[model samples]
Target: MTEPVVIGSERSEVGLPAAMEILLSGGSALDAVETALRRCEDNLEDHYVGTGGLPNARGEVELDASIMIGSSRAFGAVAALKGYPNPISVARAVLEKLPQHALLVGEGAAFFAQECGFATADLLTDEARRLWREALGPSVESVEGENTAAGAGDEAYRAASLELVRRLAPHDGPWGTINVLALDRSGELVVGVSTSGYPYKYPGRVGDSAIAGAGNYCDLRYGGAACTGRGELSMRAIGARAVVERLALGDDPESACAAMLTDAATLPDEFRAELRTLALTFDGRHGGAAGQVGSVYALMTATSAEPEFRARRVV
Candidate 1:
């Protein structure tokens, strides 16, 4: 049997070593993938996911995450979740406890997390809040309360604040996320993704990170794929599923990722430049591509002592 292997989006390096240890210890692919993403979620330095993550325009941290067990194609997801710091674990619990459901959102997701014994915390950190205020500039003080939009009694001020938010929202710029894919020695594949969603987004906004086909897709019979960056474009194109479908058709991992990057290039320049994808085949082949230059991804195998960071192929 082949040794287990794991690959992930660029930021996965923060947790890849631990994930490989899990696989080496005879852990299931699902466990390895989940463990890896959980580590990323705990990395306070990464302002895009879990603890210390950036908040929405309302100054609340809303998270999204998903997990897929390729052997059975079982998928679980949570979106627009608040208070919880580990949406990936919540997603895994959803997969195990809610066999009949594939997704939970907003208050329902939060409720499920609490039922699963997950603790709640104010996910926003001072650093993230500082960044948010920086993006909003001097106009931030004009808005009332935690609301992104202007409250009643200030029509003109509200209009200006809204316009500033539209121009400066993190969704319009570069962002980060974590996608972990594992192939166990027995050939079982599992993929997962986690993110705090775009910074300074409106309340209840959800990105591709929690959406199955858009953020993550896995099929033991084919392979697995995950994506990051301007998630709206990825969701519109079903980006991750398209990459896995290409692998299913017998394309090499690099070819499959490049093909999808090329397709994404046709979108508006802003969206196209922010598009990126990571792919892995059932046989253990893996690669990534990005619409923007200089992007990269990480890879690790059970036999590898450490993760390898490789530049992504640009379309």
Candidate 2:
């Protein structure tokens, strides 16, 4: 039996302990991944995911999440999902109940979540609304017309969202999805990621977090990988899947993660920004890396008292 382990983003500090509980109890990686991410989603202070996350220019909290099972390479993802606090659970449900589809977005994803008996909540917290209001300034009043923010197809809202998308550095921070990757006692590998995406982004702009092989990938034969930071870099490089492919071809954890960033660097400078990754092998080896220096990730084992912060290699 392989030793159980959990690895994730820096913000996953809110989740590691809960995930460890599931792993130490001899639970499956799938369960651990879901539990970990759900815990993070409930952290109202994080402001980068779930309830307190920053909103799009229209002042909406659109979320994205994905889950993958290594053994069978099963995958499910949702993008631009509003009103759901635990998108990871919804993603997992999609994996189990809709194997024929790989992704769901917008109204379809929300409808499916309702079918799954998931409760809807106002994902926007007071803090999030404050941030959105501060970010939008006076223009928010004009952009948020009488029509509901969700249903507003007014040209003013569209133009405002586009303007915000153009002016802001899409990757203003080094943060992205909270990736929760777990290796179960039975040796199964599962990777999950959740995020509200770039702050004040264009409405309906889906990032890498919602794409399986881009932001996350897994295969029991090798392991699993997840990306954070700049989601576009992962999407462009197919970073998560590339990391797993390298591991399958005999690369070490560190080298595999570094190569994933290198693959991302091949993108034209205009398209590139920050990209970070966490990798775990089926045999239990793990590491993290980033396109920028001084970045860090979190790791915890069944025997660990707490998650360890590791400096990510700059590649």
Candidate 3:
């Protein structure tokens, strides 16, 4: 059996420690990853994940999340989900109760959440509303607290599309999503990822976070990888699975992540943004890499009290 450990993306202060608690108690990796990610999904201060996350063009909190089990390679994901809290839990339910489906989107994902007993709640906090209104000024006022993407004129969405392009341009760093990967005493590895997606993205746009083998991927033999920034790049490259495949081919965690980012570099610059990856080898060794400078990841072990932060190796 491998020594239990947990690793997370940035802003996982509360998440990593909580996940470590689960591992220390001999919990399964699936439960630990879900618990840690749920903590992040509830963090209002962290606008990149669950509640309080940045809104889309229609000013709605459309959450995306996925959970993957390594040993069985079974995973479930939901994209464009709204009015529900803790999308990671919903994704897990899809894996457990609806094994035939691996992905659900839009109203379908929300319906599944409802069937599983997850009550619909307003995900847009006051702070998020302020940010949306401030970003789009009068464009989003009519749509506040409601989604009219289907009936609204293109005039409203036009502004958001332009703003989205501007935001995608080169910048200091763009951060979104929360990732948690855990290895338990039973040698199981699990990966969980959740995000509100690109700020002010066109309504209904799904990023890499909800795409298994892109944003989150794992195998009991090859380990797992989770993505952070620039979901577009990750999706184009199938980022997470690419890294783990390198590990299966004999690359160490650091080398595997570096190689994966190197391939991502081939993608066109028009949509490229800083892409970071968090990885763990099957034996529980952890490492990460970033397409931009100054990006970081976090890690914790069963014996540690807090997660240690590390700058990801730049591609």
Give the candidate number with the greatest lDDT.
Answer: 2
Encode model 2's per-residue lDDT on 26-94: one tens digit a residue.
Answer: 988999999999999999877788888888877889999999999999999999999999999999999
Q: Which ten residues in a row have the lowest lDDT in candidate 1?
A: 165-174
State the RMSD for candidate 3.
2.9
Model 2 residue-pair collision total: 0
Give candidate 2's TM-score: 0.93
**Candidate 3 lDDT by residue in tens digits, 77-165:** 99999998899999999999999999999999999998999977789999888876776666555554565455546664665667664
Weakest 10 consecutive residues of candidate 2 by summed lDDT: 166-175
CA lDDT, candidate 2, residue 26: 91
Instruction: Give the worst 10-residue stretch by lDDT in candidate 3.
Output: 165-174
lDDT of each: 0.85, 0.86, 0.86
- Which regions of candidate 2 are displaced past 4 Å? 144-161, 170-174, 269-271
Could you estimate the TM-score for every candidate? 0.93, 0.93, 0.92
- Model 2: which residue pairs collide? none
